[model samples]
Target: MEFENRDEYIIKKYQQDEETMIQLYVQWCSNHQIDPIALYQRAYPGQVQNESLLKAVEEKDQESIEISSDTLLEVLQMFGNDDLAFAVTEEIQKRSKR
Candidate 1:
């Protein structure tokens, strides 16, 4: 449980909470009528390699788009949902502990 750095610990937790992050991403995207995959790609560009996640968005599958926590927050903020983005980050940090 000991982390060498705070960022390392936060990244670990963020990865652990991928499902929650994806849920928040989908909800935010749906609420704003934005394409989750497009937003994710825009946030990370060539860094995105999750075909399943992209496929989910391409197919309009709301419940299957699994986005990374960092990408989700970036996309949210990109769309001007700073409050919701912060909430999602807080929720992910909380859920990762459990």
Candidate 2:
């Protein structure tokens, strides 16, 4: 995931291979019938060591990285999470407009 200044190819490769993680996330969220947008807000407990996505935001950080438009569709497809992608896009848009 979040290698600082890494090659684009490497990031995509990782995203493709470990995509099951996101798939699992989608399935779980769907089963819970939870608002996907709400999931973005609940604080994750403890230090989560996500080997992929390569970076984790601290509990206090509100701004997430802009998922590049070129890779946006790929990310949506990879996780079967259009809602999450849209939510992220909305945040990015709101921040940009600010």
**Which candidate gets the maximum lDDT versus the true structure?**
1
Clashes of each: 0, 2
What overall lDDT goes with each candidate model? 0.61, 0.46
The stretch of ten residues in a row with the least summed lDDT in candidate 2 is 52-61
Query: For residues 24-92, what per-residue lDDT tens digits would candidate 2 score against the true structure?
Result: 433333443433334444322243534432322122124333334436546565656565556656654
Quick one: how many clashes does candidate 1 have? 0
Name the regions of candidate 2 deviating beyond 4 angstroms.
1-16, 19-67
Q: What is the per-residue lDDT of model 1 for residues 1-98, given as tens digits with 9 covering 90 to 100? A: 45568889888786556544455676556655556666565555657466646544555544544456687778667656576566666656765797
RMSD (Cα, Å) of candidate 2?
12.2
Q: Candidate 2's error at 85, in angstroms? A: 0.5
Per-model root-mean-square deviation over C-alphas: 11.5, 12.2
Give TM per candidate: 0.40, 0.33
Which stretches in model 1 have alpha-carbon errors above 4 Å? 1-16, 55-98
